[model samples]
Target: MINETELIEQLKRGDDTAFRTIVEQWQDMVYNTILGIVQNETEAEDLAQDVFIKVFEKIGTFKGDSKFSTWLYRIATTTALDHLRSRKRKKRSGFLQSLSGSGGEEKEQIPDFHHPGVSLDNKERAAVLFKAIDELPDNQKAAYTLHKLEGLSYRDVSEVLNTSVSAVESLMSRANQNLRKQLEEYYNKHYR
Candidate 1:
């Protein structure tokens, strides 16, 4: 097994094999991180590719102060957030254009995102949960998703989020409370 130091050196030297190895090792983590935030398979796939591109381009700047995965997670998270922010801008502009009776197209409805990591019996519940997650503040969403969904430890999550573990815990607490409220409202509205 190649040590991380060796892998980093290989990557820094622009070895195609080293880059491919890194991608193979880390692709799932990257994909899941983006998917957890972006909540769309197609967009997640595209953004995962984008993450690797950025990783290759910026590999030289990676200081060894943290675990390689943590650094990669930071990159993935930032890329996903940027994609989401840009999409939000486009959506808002589209809404405004439509309201102004310009030649804007109607808004496209995003289907409930079902996580591939979920089991068949849990798909519905997961979809509902994802909707609630989508409504969370970005910090809370990142904390919850990285910890609960991606199975990162609090310390790992803190490193990825660049916050203290206690902060991650607080964000997770708020996430759970908010999720409970959102699910309760959903159930009351639809299942009553």
Candidate 2:
């Protein structure tokens, strides 16, 4: 295995092979981080590619103040959140257009999303869980996704989010409470 320092140095020097190696080493991690946030395979895949492209373009800005993975996670999280915001904006605009009768487009229906990381037996439950996760505030959602779905430690999540560990802990606590409320509502409606 190439030393991470050497690989990064080569990447900084614009070595194509080093860039390829870095992508190969971190692609799955990047993809999974994005997938957990976006909760859609195609968008996650596309966002993962965008993350790498940003990495290549912005590698010079990496000051080595934090672990490379921390920086990469920050990039992934930001990119995914930006895409979500853009989607929300487009949806809102579409809604307004329909209200004004300028848009002949029918209402768009998002299908139930299933994360591939979920097992077959738990797919339905996982889908419900992800929907609740989607309702969390952005900070809580990012903290929860990093710490729970991506298996990152609270401290690691804090670094990626550029916040204190205590903030991450608080976010996780709020996220859990919100998710419980959302899930309970879902179950009450369907199973009660």
Instruction: In model 2, state the lDDT of residue 16.
Output: 97
Tell how far residue 87 is off in model 2, in angstroms. Answer: 0.5
lDDT of each: 0.92, 0.92
Candidate closest to the true structure, highest TM-score = 2
Model 2 Cα lDDT, one tens digit per residue, 1-192: 889889988998999999999999999999998998888999999999999999999999998999999999999999999999998898899899999999747978777889888899999989889889988988899999999888999999999999999999999999999999998899899994
Model 2 deviation from the true structure expressed as Cα RMSD, one decimal place: 1.1
Per-residue alpha-carbon lDDT of candidate 1 for residues 27-104, written as tens digits (9 for 90 to 100): 998999999999999999999999999999999999899988999999999898889889989989889898889966
Clashing pairs in 2: none
- Model 2: residues with Cα > 4 Å off, grouped in runs: 104-106
TM-score of 1: 0.96
Error of 1 at 191 (Å): 1.4
Off by over 4 Å in 1: 103-107
Clashes (N, CA, C under 3 Å) per candidate: 0, 0
RMSD of each: 1.2, 1.1
